[model samples]
Target: MRFDFEGKTALVTGAASGIGRAIALELGASGALVVISDLDAEACRSVVEEIAANGGNACVFAADVSDEDAMREAVEFAQRKGGDLHMAVNNAGIGGPSVPTGEYPAADWRRVIDINLNGVFYGMRWQIPALLRAGGGSIVNMSSILGSVGFAKAAPYVAAKHGLLGLTRTAAMEYAQQGVRVNAVGPAFINTPLLSANLSPETLEALAVMHPMGRIGTPEEVSGLTCFLLSNRASFITGSYHLVDGGYTAP
Candidate 1:
């Protein structure tokens, strides 16, 4: 799908891989000056090079999303490279250890919350003002299907995702009159490098069965909806959670 992002600037966290990378590349292809951000500097550069090769404009910004200062610097870097920030995808996150709530370690819980939930908060802390300064823009927080429903043995991740929806809605309502829109995208199991590396073939197949479509989603599938929300086409859509879950949450 073609989106008109000419003269706009977009920042995508976790752009080194997975859905974030797909979104960054899509934004670049749509004519937005993309700021590819992730912890891996070299991987970020690689994504930028790919964008350039495709005749799109992009730059790299390496930062750990869990760090408030680093997130601030990321927004600043985006402004420095492409003027005011017009769009942002707070997509950086990590899946903490899988354990029952009773067995979940305090440190692991904090770490998960820090990266998955606090990270988005930190990104928006800086991004919201930047978007306002740009005369209004869009922000998409990458939530997961777990945001809408509970999954056993993933308490921290589920709790963080659920919290993100509230954050997204609050920000959306707060900025609605100001023309800055905030929304969240919830995706189900997606076939990405991280999933491929972590899950066995049998495990993946089992996951696919959970979706009504009988298969895991792709990063590009999630990116398409993300880019749509960021585009002007979704001007009236805000404070909403859009799911790209292949009917995973339908039943």
Candidate 2:
């Protein structure tokens, strides 16, 4: 069955580009009033403009997910734009400190925890109460295959993503009876611009070979599963982590 979010309101973080931007646009196109946010003010507005140009409902807010005040304001801005809050995608994050834990710089470690882990937490901390007031909603936290398993040189990121699962599960349990659902989407080697910061041709080939499907993934691929989890189609699917990886975890 097709999932439709007609008349719903959604707020997506890190929506300036990549997976976050795609998710925001897709949700808007699906009949939801969308509020797109990013750390970059201009980029966030640009994405919102693009969404509007495509005949979707959207507005933009600039905020750093790591900043408690900024995230709070973003949600407030979304509510003012949409007139209500029904859903949110806590997708703002960064892969920080790719070295061994012992050697990982303290500054880098803090940055990863601040954005990757703490930022998600902040988003949820503020969003949950808002969702409750709006009669409950769904929240999708962006995770990665790294959330389930591990890889070399990504200790901080792996640790943070793992912690996110624990948070998602706990929140889902706590809110299951409250008309709210919390879930996660864990993708593997999705070809988003984020990859440009790390993966090169050689590494891309290695990643493609690593997945049992013999291919990487796309942001839209992840968004498809995410939208499902956000809609009523996944009403009974809270507290679960859905992997959108190309069978990378399978033996």
Clashing pairs in 1: none
User: Could you give candidate 1's per-residue lDDT for residues 63-170 as a string of tens digits?
Assistant: 999999999999999899888999999999999898999999999999999999999999999999999999999999999999999999999999999999999999
Residue 21 shift from truth in candidate 2, angstroms: 1.1
Q: Report residue 11 deviation for candidate 1 (angstroms).
A: 0.5
lDDT of 2 at 42: 91
The clash count for each model shown is 0, 0
Error of 1 at 205 (Å): 0.4
- TM-score, structure 2 vs. true: 0.96
Candidate with the greatest lDDT versus the true structure: 1
For model 1 the local lDDT of residue 198 reads 96
TM-score of 1: 0.99
lDDT of 2 by residue, 1-251 (tens): 35688888898998888899889878977889888888887988888888888888888788889899988887788788777789999998887756887798989988988998999999998889889988989999999899999889988899899999999999999999999999999999888888866778888888899999998898889888889999998889999999988889987
Q: State each model's CA lDDT, in order.
A: 0.96, 0.88
Best model per TM-score: 1
